[model samples]
Target: MSLPLAIISYLILGESDTWFTTLGTYLYFILLPVFWVGYTVGKKILGIRIVNLDETDVSFWTMIKRQLIANIFYILTLGIGVIVSAFMVGIREDKRAIHDFIAGTYVTFHPPWQK
Candidate 1:
């Protein structure tokens, strides 16, 4: 999703290639500590939010670890790892993907009425 969005941003912005948007998007998501709002814009619209394994608020470093395990390394493998991770989610009762396992985080529903 992030990579696709970055590619779209790159195309819309008249960029030469996806490198800039991809790298920038990766850096922004991985390095920044976007707390409080666990969901990105799309996730918020979908009522999904990322949380720690213990259902606690996550810190900056935790997000970093998440991005590394779930996004960067997985994506670096030409999406093979991400595909496997998706299967992990489907096979598990808890629905935690490999990324969730690696990052010590999971996603939960955010009903609109709750917040």
Candidate 2:
């Protein structure tokens, strides 16, 4: 999604700093997951999705917390948090990463229940 937009942006604007690129990045990485059953394009392709632990739909704020707030910890820890998160997901019984705990969410292979 961003790739085509980036190519076009570069062609037209001669740089990737345009609003189109920013919008494409945010739409694909953030908003899409909030509205698209919690699955981004890659996650959907991988047959997994994020879900709230309470079995509710993942809200916009929750997605923000997951995507933005949790990332702060990852950055502040000099990326150790990210490494720990990967280990936790691999070794923990619940298979949850730090972001999942912070956002009260989990990734699951089970498809969301249709209305």
Candidate 3:
């Protein structure tokens, strides 16, 4: 959802291929806050949340770093990053991916009202 929005935004802005690489960077800033607030807006909507490896709420800086790392991988690979990210999450003890590891965070399911 967020990815599409970003692409659409770029298209609307008439960005060229050369500027494509920068889109991920822009999206990082755009999404970082959303991710930091409660793991992710999507996760929040889905009744899930992310915490740190230490079992505390994830910090804003951590989310920013995670977004930076994940978006870099995402841009480098055409779209393979998603698959890699999924596998990493699936294999992680706390259901975290490369981004989470870089940020020292863990994702977990939560009840809606609790959010």
Candidate 4:
């Protein structure tokens, strides 16, 4: 995903622009909401889904909040956020990332038969 954006930036803005990297960083923020919605929607289609820590359906606002926090940490950390995010998931009792924690959400395995 970032690859295409990088390529596009290079093509349009010239490879020499330092702002390309900044634009790529901003692009991440732009993609977060779209990504979360797509991820949740896809999970629903697959009969597995994400919910809140309380096992309630994830709200759009919550998803946005989660994405915002996670993205901020990601941008600030200069890509180390992936590792931190993954570690957050591993350490969480319910297996949630920092985004999930901020959003009060959890991903759970749901069998297709039950859906």
Best-matching candidate per TM-score: 2
Alpha-carbon runs more than 4 Å astray in model 1: 1-14, 31-33, 75-78, 111-115
Angstrom error at residue 58, model 4 = 1.1
Q: Which ten residues in a row have the lowest lDDT in candidate 1?
A: 28-37
TM-score winner, 2 or 4 = 2
Task: For candidate 4, write residues 7-89 as lDDT tens digits.
Answer: 77788877734577666655454354345532443465675566666655555576667766677877888979778779877
User: 1-115 in candidate 2: lDDT tens per residue?
Assistant: 7788889899999996789897777667678878898898889999988889976778898888887889889999999999999999889998999999889999888788741
The residue ranges of model 3 lying beyond 4 angstroms of the native Cα positions read 1-36, 73-82, 111-115
TM-score of 3: 0.58
Per-residue lDDT, model 4, residue 93, is 74
User: Which candidate number would show the highest lDDT if scored against the true structure?
Assistant: 2
TM-score of each: 0.68, 0.81, 0.58, 0.54
Instruction: Give the per-residue lDDT of model 3 (tens digit) for 1-115.
Output: 4456557656777653335446554555446544565544566677676666656666667667777676787778887877888987778666677677778876677532354
The candidate, 3 or 4, that scores higher on lDDT is 3
Number of the candidate with higher lDDT, 1 or 2: 2
Ranking by TM-score: 2, 1, 3, 4
Q: After aligning candidate 1 to the native by TM-score, how far in Å is the CA of 47 from where it should be? A: 0.4
Candidate 3: the clashing residue pairs are none
